[model samples]
Target chain A: MREPISIWCFSGVLLFIYGLLIFASGLWELAHPLLHPPVLHQLHAPIWWGAILTVIGLWYLIEFWPHKRASQPKE
Target chain B: MFPATNLWMVSHLAGMVAHPQSGLIAAITPSGMVRLSPVDLIIIAVYFVLVVFIGFYLKESSNTGEDFFMAGRQMTAWIAGLSFVSANLGSLELMGWAGSAYQYGILATHWYWIGAIPAMLFLGIVMMPFYYISKVNSVPGYLQLRYGPATRALSGITFAVMTILMSGINMYAMALVMKVVLGWDLNFSIWVSAITVAAYVALGGLRSAIYNEVLQFLLIWAGSLLVPILGLIEVGGWRNLEKQIIHNVGQTGYLHMWTTLGHFNTNPMGVNWFGIVFGLGFVVSFGYWTTDFLVVQRVLSADNLRSARMAPILGAAFKMMVPFIVILPGLLALSVLPFKLVAQDIAVQTGQHSFNEVLPLMLVRYCGPGLLGLGVTALIAGFMSGMAGNVSAFSTVWTYDLYGAFMNKKASDEHYVKMGRWCTLIGVLVSIGTAYLVQHAASIMDYVQALFSFFIAPLFGTVLLGMLWRRATAAGGFWGLLSGTLTSFGLWEWVERDPSALRYVALSPDAKAMAQDIFRALWAWVVCVIVTVVVSLLTKPRPVAELEGLVYGVSPIPEEHDDHWYQRPMVWAGVVFAVFVVLNVIFR
Candidate 1:
């Protein structure tokens, strides 16, 4: 149970999504010069970093939350 | 060929040739045996014996995992205070500062005060309360309390990787200094120091590291102070050195603090004041103070919250004194020896290896013999303490946060104690590989900063949201972490490709400035807090207990949680902030 759970998190579907965006941005830069050439390389940067921050945000929302108010006590 | 020859025009022409200013060039005679005598060997042996003896004396008390990690969690403010400063003030500052001051002109000193001094103050006061009250093993472990097991485990692995990487860099950086100063073989120093640090750290954990840190701190301060004093006298006093530098550079504004600085964004190649502060100083100072486990473990082990808070405060106090030792010597080195010359001297002194030769080269040429040995020993002391601190934290994290938390939460104190030693051994071995690989890698500081950004930024998000916002969920933590990482790195990669973004990245002329800026942004503690706070406000609220912990402290599990500051955490946090601000103003 623990092994699978940890692995799923590491693979991180969202991280992949961000990586794809960066790849696209890089490709975009190679094809078309937008703004300065320097600015173009910068375009890919935010996706992965943004993805990283988003993941952190979601985790904080989940962990500190109290267990849903019980319908009936376990006891 | 020209109409008239003015000195400033001559310098400006030379500056055009170099494309900025006249750079330093090294003067050295290579192909000679190191000055390391049997007396030097004896000095090393005696230092080793004392350090090891301290480890053994402290080891019996380190019978439990808790004792090994947090010194039975009985640490006081002052000990934690000094150890923190000692860990940071190392070969990096010594070599990097000298190298930069020599090459870049007067801009190096500005990098220290503006980039690090304030960041240290803000982090020391604002973040200390959380760590003191929460009492976790690694900075990531704090995340587990706020997020979930997955985030905690991720934090653990990354923290371990980052520490080992830094240890490897430190290993290489230290050996480089030795090679330059003592004229020893680079390979020889690296191999010997790696073994020495591993052996000592594997035997004793944070206790040994912290205890030894007290000694290193003293040596670092003494040797650092001694070097400049002697060098100034040797060069016919500060008056001559200062005059020569002003004449050579042809611009005295570099000496002025109020001079606005620029960075990659504005300058493309260098940084100015804005970049130094928001970029280098704000980012790196916060990351190290708030997130890095090597320093935090000392505070977390404190007897109570009061002691923990004081550690960073005192460390910052000491940080304010750094320019005296590291920065000023670098400035002195700049005036006396050009960087190019220093580089060549380092090569001759350190056998023509890479950057490792810079510091030791300066030491040998500049300082006299007795002081030379003392400075060399101090370098060793600085490095050993750093290696010890990292290995100690690594061992504790592996044993408690992972081994205990996952494999055997129910294990006895005895089992955990034994596990701690094994953990440290594993951690040290990992560092050996990292050090071996790091010699060939890019700038050690940059690589370390990059690795840290991956974990520390996200973990910072988890904890901040957990503390400041009640609605922060495990899911929220997960999302926030992912978001903040992408944001900071987005900034990082953008800067990397454009190079102009480097202005925002480090915004300092020196590696330490760059390191500090990148350190600050990579973690992006501010981004984490702001995002977590605003996001949580828009979301639902957590139960009262969770909110209470956000305000107060991580409450002990299996209780309703009373009196421990969870309910009134805001009051305490406000107090920490006010004190931090006051310290900054007075110190500045």
Candidate 2:
């Protein structure tokens, strides 16, 4: 009954991509504080948010990897 | 030559000082909304790309009519539940009710709780068994089963028209927000959102729409959670927010829910407790949560009877908490954000007491660039989820119930699937046109509520009677529906004909449009019930065999999958009821 694509798989991929972007942004902002506007220069919300996204994305990915593998052999 | 960055900053500061209030608050201008940093743009681009990817990804698997329209009946409880509530959590619900909370105070929470929970529980425990067991693909399809084709056609066409019009209203509402926040061209905003929704909906069908809705639910939560959290922190927590709001608004009633609701004069809602409990909580709320196809369609896509029934219960649990995300921002706006500045332009656009830019203003104040993009994206996600909900429901009803049933009954399933796609395209285009038409009308929230009173309230009455009463004849159903609809119109028209007439019913002169909507729904429900009962008794009832799976008493009940006592629907209902009482008592 497994479809070719499900919401969980794509949610993982997309969340991963989004997490990667936030993580990179957090690193970049932390490395070069002068480039960012003063309002955003000091806030660590991005770093924390990015870390949360990373953890969530990894969980979805780990959960989905086996399902994808199981369905691949049938295809 | 280009201006220096320093010079541009100086000019921006000067512009802020030139505003009515002298502070760092920038006047909402076109460039300010669109002038996202590189990181912000990248984030939004990623979101859109992922959304389109999800849409087309599911398209390949959806080959059959069932797959296209109903997700092949494979949705789990959480998916169905989330999509059910998310579909209802559209831009109108978020932006409109948030603004209502600002204007009407904590009493607006009534729409979230008392107005929703009881009816949602009713739908879950009592009504869904019939819907799932009867195996109707759409609500109109159910009508066709219960009352015959005449009732189906009437309900079908009314629902189809209402869905498209409501979809267009969502488009229009979103465009209004964009124009106010981003200063984007109205037509451009409408087309961008319309095209995006149409593309995904047409590509992947209901499955795609539901999947994206779940995603939007998460995004909305992620994006909006910070506003209340930060707002609470900035205001020194909930107690401080209450005190500051009272000081700023000069009213203690804004902090309490039921205390001021004793009379219209005492409440900011301008609605007495009787009107709040009966008009909204009973009639309007039941009419909408119990019967609206846009929401019911999500639950209908569930895998089995248990999932279908549990969907709304799960939805009700989540639904009870939504006021925190949507309404809290409005409450925060009353204290943390300056009223005079944000109210300047939105007041002109919406023709309301305060600016409806509560959420957007709060976002601007609290979020910096990176988080700002995520916040705005969440708002966009909300708008798109709503549009998708409307368009997808419209396409299904148009394809299965209207086009498939009436125009060509003998078509193949594949043919119907193709037709559904075409209808999705056409539905979005029609909504775009309707969005433009709605620009000249009054506020989006008021217009939407009035339409619900006219259409959904009556429809709910007919549906409630048909499901519970097997003796109810088809002739009774048809006439009851017709009478209920006409009565709502007649009452609304009478009020419009003489503006002073509302006072005769003890309505305040400055009562919000929602009050009138409540009264109209109450009267319409009464009319529908009366006409239906009177007509039903005069006609011969359908045979018990014909009513077996469709009616409450004669229907062979399905076995409960919930082997454990805690999993029972009644237990969940009781738990939800207890929590609702606790919330009311605490907020009261």
Candidate 3:
């Protein structure tokens, strides 16, 4: 059987990278205060944003992986 | 992070905004550079890489003419819906509207809500079945099926030219933003954007463009979400933002949407409810949302009739949130950014600068380095997506509608696909020249909206009457369209020749170009409907048997009853309408 090409594969990878960037930016903002100030003077906002993005990314990965794997060739 | 950098930017922005005559500063000093931090660079790099990756990934999927032009009719509702809105949420929208917000205040939100929501809902519920079930490849093809070949040719050629011109304007706007915010060279910026859009669109065709649009949509949200959130917090929430705006501008009307629209003199839009309702809402908005191929092409790519119907509805839902990010930032800039000009004489000596840089200025003031990079990337993504949307639509229409219809008459699928690719490249190159021509306009957004009134308003009148009224004949469609377009041009020329002439029509004396645009659309639309009806009555109409699925009552409705009640198009449209009412009431 041909492998099913899910739109999720494309959307998932893009979201995952975006999530990781937001997470890293939050960590960087926390670590280097003078270089990158907390956006709008709230330290917690970035952290929360990071967590939300990370979860969205993980959700795409977890939900779509089985369908993707099931359609792959056994070899 | 850098207090010194912040101080420098604030002082420079103050110099620019104090004078109203100059456009953007001719050149930024070395200190004005918005350098991306390592983290920010990485984020932007990843964004570009992903865009290229998606284009290449979808290349193989577009093997045939159908796949290349229409995505092989395999798009889900969510993907098509997101792409539909993303194609619209381009640089012209983000930057142009933010500047408009700064200049016109929250009245600009009407363009997003009442100006858009109803028409989008109408498209999904009433028009999608005709478009989807008929299986016409392009909107012009539908015209051909409904009216005749002549109507299709007129509309198709005009649409092709307009789409390319729109793409060029988008490219020009994007380059202008980059030059202002990042101090990038203007020509360099234009060429880079032009090349990038042409590359991906030519390779992956409509599917690649749609996929990238979905990706860009997410980035736009993520990048722009912070502006309102942080802006509200800084300004002490929505009430405070309202307070600050009133304090800054000395007007309570700026905060309320529909309340001030009772009279032309009361609102910043400088037009009354009649113009907003009958002109923008009924004519301009409906014309753009319902008939513009830039957006309809996305819906046409849907996998099923249900998906096609749901696409615009989903887009309408997302369209509601746009003003929050794009407009609120402009309002926020009024409170935060400085407007103390260099000096009256110095402004004369040094050249005055406009506040068109409102969004970029706010970004500099609010966002830190990493987040700043992401935000800038979002702006670039928006511009490219918009250009790509225009380019892809242009190629499809040019290849299928004009080239295939008249030039070749009978060509293989492979031959047409090659022609589409060539058209895509030529379209982008021509757009680069069109970009240069856009410099004559006073404001980018106003220029774009004016183009809509001139071209699209009349087109909408003809299409709307043709779709619902089967009595509309081919001669009526052609002559009605021709007269309406000519009427719009004459109105514009008359108004330009004598500024006082509009007062005779009951428009305000001091009304800006935008208000004139509204009235112009109204006149053209009226002319179109009257002419179409009169001509159709005098001419022989096509037989009812021939109309079939192309007309409203001539054919059986597609099998959509098996779906759940909640999933019905009417149900979704009702929900959208309810939300639209609640929003207007609250804002009013």
Please give the CA lDDT of all the candidate structures.
Answer: 0.56, 0.77, 0.77
Off by over 4 Å in 3: A1-5, A35-39, A42-44, A65-75, B1-33, B338-353, B436-452, B505-510
* Tens digits of lDDT, candidate 1, B71-113: 7776666677787767666655555555555555445554555
Model 3: what TM-score? 0.91
Q: State the weakest 10-residue window (summed lDDT) of model 3 chain B.
A: B1-10
- Each prediction's TM-score against the native? 0.71, 0.90, 0.91
TM-scores of chain B alone in all candidate structures, in the order given: 0.79, 0.91, 0.91
For residues B1-588, could you state the per-residue lDDT of candidate 3 as single tens digits? 001111222233333333423433443344233656787778777877777777776788888999999988899999999998888887556766776677778888888898889889999998888888889888898888888889899989988987887787677766666655666666887898888788888888999899889878887887888877777777888877777778888988777888888787888778888888888788888888888888999999999998999999999999988888888998887776657223224554566434456776667666776667778888888888888998999999999889988899788999999999899999999999877765443244344444545778898998888889999999999889889988988887788779787874436675665677778888898898999999999999999988898888887877876457898877887898899899889988
The digit string of per-residue lDDT tens for model 3 on A1-75 reads 434445666667766776677677777767767454534746455566767777887788777653423454778
Give candidates' CA RMSD values in order: 19.7, 6.6, 5.3
Instruction: For candidate 3, give the docking quality class from DockQ.
Output: acceptable
Task: Please tell me the TM-score of chain A for candidate 3.
Answer: 0.66
Q: Give the runs in model 1 whose Cα sits over 4 Å from its true position.
A: A1-75, B1-34, B183-187, B234-241, B262-269, B338-358, B440-449, B457-462, B490-539, B549-588
Against the native complex, each candidate's DockQ, computed on alpha carbons, is 0.01, 0.37, 0.44
Q: List the residue pairs that clash in candidate 3.
A: B22-B352
lDDT of 3 at B356: 53
Compare candidates 2 and 3 on lDDT and give the better one: 3
